[model samples]
Target: MGVPATVSSTSSTLPWNVHRLPRADGSVFLVTGGNAGIGYFVAEQLSATGATVVLGSRNPAKAENATASIRARIAGARVRTVRLDLADLSSLQSVVESLEVECLDAVVHNAGVALDDPPRSETPDGYELMFGTNHLGHFALTWWLMPLLSAAPAARVVTVGSFAAKSERLDLDDLQSRKGYQPKRTYGRSKLAQMHFGIELDRRLRAVGSTVASVVVHPGGALDSLTPSRPPIHVPTTGARLSAAPAALLVQGKHAGAWPAVRAVLDPAVLGGQLWGPRVFGLRGEPRREPVWNHLADTSVAARLWDASCDLTGVDPGAIPG
Candidate 1:
């Protein structure tokens, strides 16, 4: 069944509070951008629950340090490091090949690019960098790793979306912003694509009778000022600090923002096709199964976006059943 169109309750407490989350001792999870930000907190909390976590970072040194920090905080925490750059397909392929695990319990597609006004950039593949890295990269990674996730008794693919998606509509005709590009618009579109992909992927998995589940969640306005300082990972720049100073009053801590995604990963009741996020004003409060944007429900758009992602990345979703 699809998520209810409206929620009846007004509970302030989270359904997937860290203290109440189930232990995951034997499972393995791979988290992209796990080295810092909300991703870092997600990795830490997962490891705290006894799950074996593989932290994905574009920089080997950063991954190593992040792993070390986790181990330091949680004695006997099982953590490993893998170099992953979402903007580069070759890097993703290499990481997929190097994996030795028999089953991947969950994958947190958390890495993405976000900025206010920035020069337009492109990925190594010559696609718009924001859309390419935030959406297509994750699309390809999930496609390549689906087999491993399927091997597990019950596995999940958690795609981290953004509150920014609500502010902008997707322009399917100009996904790359070829005509003209605005940084925030492109970023919002990228997140919208990710959310759309998650919903569509859920439909596909169900169609094939696949056990693997796909869920989308967002950290509500998680800002640098609200997020804890972690060197090299959560470092604040002058511009970032200036922007965050005002936002600090409105934004939730990165850790609090991460709860929705973490809950999406571990909550057994979570069904595919549900969009999860904070319950209070969709920004900060508690994790809940929120309704997705109306446009995201348009299956036609989902199918086209999925096809476009596959075409751009050259990672065929058809290769996986459903």
Candidate 2:
């Protein structure tokens, strides 16, 4: 499904309220992996702003159900779905070509894969599953979608990072995690790579004097148990909510988890290269501009990661003329 493209009147001069998004009438945004979890909520919230929301999902049925849920809650909401499989590198261009919009106001890079425990797996391109999908996939997608993004007056690319990435470091030599793979650690590193990419992308975009902004955000400790019901998608039982009540004091539900990304997308004052996360102890609270972690601030590492990503994906995000 598709909605007609329109000029965006999104302005940074407007006041911002996290609970209530700025009106984005005539804008179009894409939320990868928007079928469920935090992505779903991002789509729902964006839909309320009157922006045409495109949900990128690998499953058609789930995508339709998500769009239906959004329509059910927000009257006259405009939403569409596109088949997107980040793991399959060859198919990405086709996905971008399929989009009917002439310009894209923003894209929330929220789709990711996490492996708790496992015999390590690789994507279709033979890269580690976590690193491949979480980092490289979005990296390539951005490259292909840059044209549409540039068409907008001030486009934003919001990358959803992870709290797990805070303590992790990238091993440039073994980015694929081929040497020794601990599922938890590997997942964290992948997200770390994503953060590095977002920051590096901002640097490149600024160096080229492009209006497109890249912002990174991480949800604190979001648990599904604390999430509100969105029937046919996520419906935590009363018992589950009760069991999670104690933890709610420290953490939050996925719905709240979507806050940082939402703010990054619509907060006009938000500049490129800024990091946004929960305000309270970096765990749970209203979204606030936060400092980049020391590990994530290493420009050398970020540059190397950018080069490695380009080599692996065969796409140079910085290829745009300065």
Candidate 3:
């Protein structure tokens, strides 16, 4: 996507620019893995639009750097940094402890690891690495931040999913990939789990009369998560730029790729349970609300995925802080 119609002269100076009509004046957001890639762009764009941003990363220094860069571009952009390692519950707890009094308007679950090598690995929490970091840790983080989220007049929780999700359905029997673990299956399964959590979270929040909206989204690849955890090859070495490119070309900046998700977070017309992604073949272009994805968005599967997530994360959805 090119610069927004309302872009400033300096907007062209940036590597990535987005147009979010900044009514986000008083909102607070906590974004996971925000130091780099899609997460960074999400935080920067939201902050430029007047939201206070709490950038979460495994490295607080990197988080600070990303935030500082945003401030340099958009003077006084309210942003801060906190250390969080999704794979480690201890690190997750530390972030919660650090934010003892901060409020949250949204939690952009963008932190994910994509390792497509031959072997299967487990997190410190003992789940498959892909599932553990991509889904479980985020599940734990969302539950950990429920109170801050519920306080807002209307808050949202955006789960960043992927097109690879089309291939993998929720695997309750092998949620941790105990029986078998293919990297693609592992990543897709994690994203599928996230989709369920988003829908289920919306249902549960409404059941309790809460004002929060949980929205699921498939950003549709083209973005290479630029962190130490995810290496270069995972970005799809050769291809057309713009995830919106043909299904064949899988090249796009993490920043340009974060559009659909930002829309899900800030678009007031968007329904609470609405799902969205890219309209183009490869999922890079103006965002459009999407219909429910089969199997992954299946209510039965979503319910099961929700329960399994709670079981693995040790977080009781019924007991989430509010």
Root-mean-square deviation per candidate:
4.9, 3.3, 6.5
Which has the better lDDT: candidate 1, or candidate 2? 2
Q: Candidate 1 — which residues are off by over 4 angstroms?
A: 1-15, 229-249
Q: Rank the candidates by lDDT, best first.
A: 2, 1, 3
TM-score per prediction, in order, is: 0.89, 0.95, 0.84
Model 2 regions more than 4 Å off? 1-15
* 1-322 per-residue lDDT for model 2 (tens digits): 0111332335445555666677788888999999999999999999998889999999999999999999999999999999999998888898777788988989999999999988999998999999999999999999989988888878888999988999899999999999878999999999999999999999899888877889999989889999989989998999998989999899998888988998888776677899999988778878999998998889999999999999999998767732
Candidate 3, 247-268: lDDT as tens digits: 4344355666777778766666
The model with the greatest lDDT is 2
Clash-forming residue pairs, model 3 = 244-284
lDDT of 3 at 292: 73
Please write out the lDDT profile of model 1 over residues 1-322, one tens digit for every residue.
2221111122123455655566677788899998888888889888887788998889788788788888988999999988889989867877776667988888999988876776788898898998989998999998888888888877888999988887777788999988788898888999999999988998888888877888999888776676766665666676767776777556687878878877777777687888998877888767888887787898998888888887888886435762
lDDT value, candidate 1, whole model: 0.81
Q: How accurate is candidate 3 locally (lDDT)?
A: 0.72
Residue pairs with backbone atoms closer than 3 Å in model 1 (clashes): none
Q: Local distance difference test, per candidate?
A: 0.81, 0.88, 0.72
**Reference-based TM-score, model 1:** 0.89
